[model samples]
Target: MCWKTLLCCSLWLLLLKSNENLAFKIPSIDFEMLHELGFEVSIPDEPGMQRVFYMLQIDDNCPALMDYITESNNGSWISRQKTSLQNNDKLQISVLVQYNDEIYEKSETRVIINARLLTTRDGRSQSITYPNGEGECHAYLSPQKQAKRCKPAQSIVSSSRQTCQGELLFEDNFSEAQLNRSTWKHDIRQRMYHVEEELVAFDDAPRNSYVKEGYLHIVPIVASEVVEGSFKLGDRCTAVESPEQECNIAQGSFYSIKPPVFSAQIHTRDSFSFKYGKIVVRAKLPKGDWLFPYVMLQPVSTYAETHYAKQLRVAYARGNSHLQSNQQEDISGSHLYGGMVVWPHGRAMQYLKDRLSKAHYGDSFHNYTMIWQRDKITLMVDEEIYGELYEGLSFFNEKCFIIFGVTVGGFLNFDDSVLAKDVKPYLNREPRAALSFWQQRDTWAPTWGKHSSMIIDYVRVYAE
Candidate 1:
């Protein structure tokens, strides 16, 4: 180091070490503005010549207290930890300032933490316990079901002294101007899902899906509107298997063309995927023949990402209104369905929990809930139990992410022979299924008015 710089640094340290004539100011605790578990330790602005450090130590009698140190941030220091301080405890904070390699203890300040809290070695409700009786206390917390004092309304874990059960894990209200891409990633591809072969292109275009007026609106549109001739998804498609086949389509014939309709599919696979939990969705079903809206799940594995593991449709609804089965039963948009795909004895099977309502699910908003356990799955609508499956979840041991989408004319979901009086437009085995659906859009497109949009008010997933 240069002689002049070294001499000035040494003099600065020596000046701060002196008790009677200090060069810089020491920090003080702002107990009056203290957080539940933090002391507002701050120091005044120091000159630009050299840096000053504030290191604080709690009294040894203070249980689980840890030391905190910080250089001034914009001329101040404020910090909080995930700990609690009991009420009416006299907290003695020893203030120290460090310059270069030297730390000098300036003075000690005594203040009451709060009126109702106290430090206790025993893990008591409303009592904070810190090991070693020093600096910060973040170790032990009570398991009570009540809220704690001085806790901010928004917190992840240990918001207060109380324990947590059925914590809300994830939620979205779609109140923003655009879809939360971080939370709900758009899967831009055509008929590439593990289950069901839909004659639809799931695009990332805002016309197919977007957030508006506090609701997530997923609308089914004609593919020709987005792409007139041969379609290619290019970089927007995330299909891992057969990217060329899954993400592109060439005009085959006048009647047989690219995926007949355009739609949207989004998922939480990138953001959130869990094994067992409770999921609730407030949504208005879509209206139109063969329009399928579902909140689905898939395991977070490459094999399951394609077609190898069991899946869960937390909730699903068909968009055909006034359709009936050949057995003289209602099989249309008025019913809600959810099922679990299980693999047992080298075979894959699916069991469903279905509910029928007097009104079309597309007519208004309804709460569709799914409670998933290790060995059971339950479905509900507006607090009423719909149905459940009592199968063990032993097939997949990995966490699964959430998926919500609106697809049109899938082979498996729409049974052509099931509809009585031949309401179905095309057979499941027909190669030109997409063209057939689009040709008859004059009859079905009228059904998909603005009210027919799949409107999701919110989706909430809670810990089980």
Candidate 2:
């Protein structure tokens, strides 16, 4: 062959070699069959294929439940975690075929999982698709047994000292359209739960909390956004994760690994700090399963002040507790026991002594008052004493500020067994079931409605 012919022949051979190297077929994924069979599938073994895997993307509406799907092995796709899919949820499945550690071809499919099949009928049985594609199967879900409400115990009075009628040091009636930034610090941090063991996202946004109708309404609603990091600080404040640093007004920092349900938390840490006084909060608490209402005081030193003296923190919590036999006792429209905790010493002083009341505080407005003096700390509900500690007077000398908010599931009081049986099915894999279940309740609008709030009529501090 001539030089020109030889060059043309070489180019043709190179083209053939390139075509052979690029020769790969996209793997066909049976998504419809996979969805029907519960999203578990076995991929056919292909020669020269080094590895195979799948990626799942949930529809935008149900994006929070996207982490449920995972790859099990080189040839299978499996959902290792428990999840709930809502009606009309679209799941996008992408299958990647690789050879020599390089991606050869990718096949993708989107499928809708019917949610009606997951809803329980009479809170017991649910219809689900069988994995073998034989037919639908009915599974019985464990019933959520309601706990009996405790009978109202005899009211207990700790000290003969009458309710504090001292001169008012400060008060917030919440009469304005917006929160008073001068008096209250809106510590809008993302997923920072260091203060309490609860599932709640604290944000500065008005939707999570607001002042309206002459009431400071701190509402816990469904989360619209996900935030991850340490606490977000206010003006002239920096985030501190260690106790070595001296922060005059510090908010504890916590790392949240997953998306959380958003709520609101505000404090007087920077704005107001008092040594000893009478603090009274008149408010109506939120009612529903797994909700926690809190009015607390933390040392301005953020526990670091204990080096000078043991720092003190006092709080009032209600809704769920280990002292009570049934964690859901408060949500059954029955008795409400306001719990008091005084830490570094984790003590439930009220319930331990059986001095609680049976009043459903969620049904109406009630007063939660704390009297702190040099020698004693007392907690009362509606002017009736529930708990008191007389010996921890030295710690009470430290200046502490107030924090008001509500929270859901967390290490503090969440019971996973109860959750899986009673609330998990309805949660649909959403992380914050308390907020989700409360928003979906039929009585939410009629009974709670816009009033689904920790309505603070007034927060007053009285000094000697």
Candidate 3:
């Protein structure tokens, strides 16, 4: 019986000692360390900040509190890293507490100075609490720099007007002396193959097709020299190749390298391709008649026949147009072929020609844009929605990049008299009588030049 009583007494003593040694939790910030650390604080509603406040319970074995300051790289400001120190110079936080003939101690707040950039683990530029209940009250450094959604999207107005102001995945500035030597490639082959090359030649034509003020101007040269060369594999033009065939040509233009060959079709296919987003190009239109203005957006999928070009003819033939008659120049059904001739086959091309004939083109520099969502593809010229293809079109099943270029004449014929007169002297031609009748005629005046050039100002793309 006495042994049992002694055992219970010893157990009670051990419990008392255990309770005495155990430490308790403490608050984050202490009043005394604020001056040394040089911290500024403000409460949401209060005039000043709270220096000390009892939060939850504390831990026992933690050492005393110490505070230290770390300034920014430019020495603009100072913030606290550690706020507690004990006899051993060990860092910790201590909370004040009182009990009858006893006092408990534990590090209160774990101060962090010189924190990494705003991250999930580090709380942020403002106050944060750790999963373990330790915390630091950091003052709000700066208001977040918000980004404005593009017009018509109803997004917040952000300060970024320049192209560099958004989430940019890739950017290449072509400041190199020889732009062709940089991120560009050419397809010298004689067939229509989409070459996965980035470096594009806009007016790789003769001296008349030079890039000035960021726009590639395609003008005529009357020196019997054919303006036929283009970046990669493309046709050229010459005066002799004019449709009239009556004028002994001084110079003719052609993309003669090959039809459907990888001409100046620059793309980010193998290197990079985006999923869903918008691309905005601030540019002006290329002038001159017989000009073929085009932008190509092609989407590829691992599921489709990668090597073979999906016959858009078959796709569009599902409509009223038959495939055989569709191929002819004067056929009414030939309207869809305009979309098919470009390298990257898709609806973006189909809508562009219709958009160009609208009132907004040629007169001003406008934003030629493409908005690709999961369900729809929209083509816009100057903020006006020209065409929209629903998700039903198979070409838009995958994401794509932007490709743009201009040609003197390929499949479409603009035999307008004003255009012909403007073009006649450069390549000696028979002056036609009826300008309006020629303009209405449907004939493909293929530019027979070897090298030609197209121009652009700036290209920008954005993602969510």
What lDDT score is found at residue 410 in candidate 2?
51
RMSD of each: 14.7, 27.4, 19.0
TM-score of 3: 0.38
Taking all chains together, each candidate's TM-score versus the true structure is 0.62, 0.47, 0.38
Candidate 3, residues 1-464, lDDT tens digits: the string is 22123224542232233336334322233322231122232112111211221222112222211222222223222223322211122122322222232333333233333111111122212211343335432221122221222222211112323332124444433333333323332211221122211111223333533345445443332222123433232243111222222111122232112122112334444444555555665544433333444444445343111233321211110111111222233311222211322235532233222332323133345666665555665656555565665634555445454444443332222322323233221221222212221232233122223222344555655543
State the TM-score for model 1: 0.62
Clashes of 3: 64
lDDT of each: 0.62, 0.48, 0.31
- The TM-score obtained by model 2 is 0.47
lDDT of 2 by residue, 1-464 (tens): 22223224532332222223456765444432321113443355566665444434444221121121122355543332122222354544444445444454343434443322221112211211123534322211112221121222211112223332233456888988889988787644433223233555556678778888898888777544333332333442332453222122123322233224556777877677776666788888766545566576666767211222133333333443222334434333234433233455553222221234455456678877776766656666665666666764654446677778876545334444434354421333344443344345443323434545677898877652
Backbone clashes in model 2, listed as residue pairs: none
Error of 1 at 140 (Å): 19
Root-mean-square deviation of candidate 3: 19.0
Indicate the worst ten consecutive residues by lDDT in candidate 3: 314-323
- Best-to-worst order by TM-score is 1, 2, 3
